[model samples]
Target: MTVYVDNARIPARVGRTSGRWSHLTADTVDELNAFAAELGLLPGWFQTCKRKCHSTLPCVHWHYDVTDKYRSAAIELGAQPIDIREMGALTTARRAALSARPKGPTP
Candidate 1:
C-alpha cells in the first residue's frame, strides 16, 4: 500500500492517490486492538487477512484509505515503515485458480 503521511486527518478520497491493501505489523490481537483503538478505530473493523510472510506477528489487512491513515499514525507511534503491494496479478491469478479447482477430490 502507498502510505500517505500528513499532520492532519485526510478529508477526502482521490483517485490515483489512493493506495492498495497492505499487510500490518502488530503480531498479537492485543497489539492490533491497542494500535487501532489508539487511532479511534474500533476493534471489530480490524480485519484478519493473509500475509505473504509466515510469522506470529499479528498481520492485518486494511483497505487503502485505512492503510494510508493508519500507516501515518504508526510512524508517529514509533512503528517501522514498510513498502509493499499485495500484487494485483497474484490476487487475480489465485482467484482464477481457485475457481477452476474442484470442490472435492475427483473419484
Candidate 2:
C-alpha cells in the first residue's frame, strides 16, 4: 500500500482555529497510521468513522488532516502527491480494504 498526500489546501477549522489543510491517506489504514507516526502525529489525529451522525452506518475513512507545514514534511518524506481524483480513488480503495477484513463478534 502506498501513502499519498493531496494538494487540496481547503479552508477548514480545526478546533477554534481555521486554516488551509491537506489530506494524507493510503490504500490501507495500517500504512496511513504508520506513515503518520513518522511525522510525529498522534494516533488520535487519525480520521475514522464519525461518532455522531444522522446515519447509523459508519463511513470508515482512514486518513489524517494535515496542515501546510505537515504537508511539506509529508512530501519530503516520500508521500506521493495526488489530486482530488486520485484522493477519491485512494479513499475508495481504503473503504474496500476495510470491507474485506474479517469481522469480529459484535459487542
Candidate 3:
C-alpha cells in the first residue's frame, strides 16, 4: 500500500513546461491511483503501456509524471521517496505480482 516517488531532480529545462518533475508509482495500481487522486491529479494524468505488443514488457511500469510542487505535496501525503536506480527492480516485482492476480469484471 506504499506509494513511491523517485529522487530525480528534474530541471525545468528538461521539458517545454518550466517545472521539475518526478515519477510517482506504487506496488499496486490501485494504491498508485489512489495516491494520485489524493494529489488532485486528473485521471488522464495516469500513464501506462497501451500497446498490445508491449503488454508483456517489464519496462512498462505504471506511474504518473508529477511536477516538483506536486512531488512535495505527495511526500507530505505519505509517498515514499526512492532513487531512480531502485525503480526498475521495484517495478518489475510489482508488475509480476499484478500479472499473476486473477482478473475481475471491469466496472
Task: For candidate 2, give the lDDT.
Answer: 0.81
The alpha-carbon deviation from the true structure for residue 92 of candidate 3, after best TM-score superposition, in angstroms, is 2.1
Which lDDT tens digits does candidate 2 get at residues 1-107? 77888999999998985888989987677888989999888899988765833233356556899988898999999989899688887656545665677688766
lDDT for each residue of candidate 3 in 1-107, tens digit (9 for 90 to 100): 78989977676553466777789998778888988998999889898777643465444478898888888899999999999888877876766775887687766
Cα-based TM-score, every candidate: 0.41, 0.74, 0.76
TM-score of 1: 0.41
Q: How many backbone clashes does candidate 2 have?
A: 0
Give residue 52's error in model 3 in angstroms. 4.3
lDDT per model vs. reference: 0.46, 0.81, 0.81
- Per-residue lDDT tens digits for candidate 1, residues 1-107, read 22222222334544544553333434344665666576666555555456642333332333223556566666776554544333333334444554576776799
Off by over 4 Å in 3: 12-16, 52-60, 95-107
RMSD in angstroms, all models?
A: 10.5, 4.1, 4.3
Screening candidate 3 with a backbone cut-off below 3 angstroms (N, C-alpha, C), the clashing residue pairs are: none
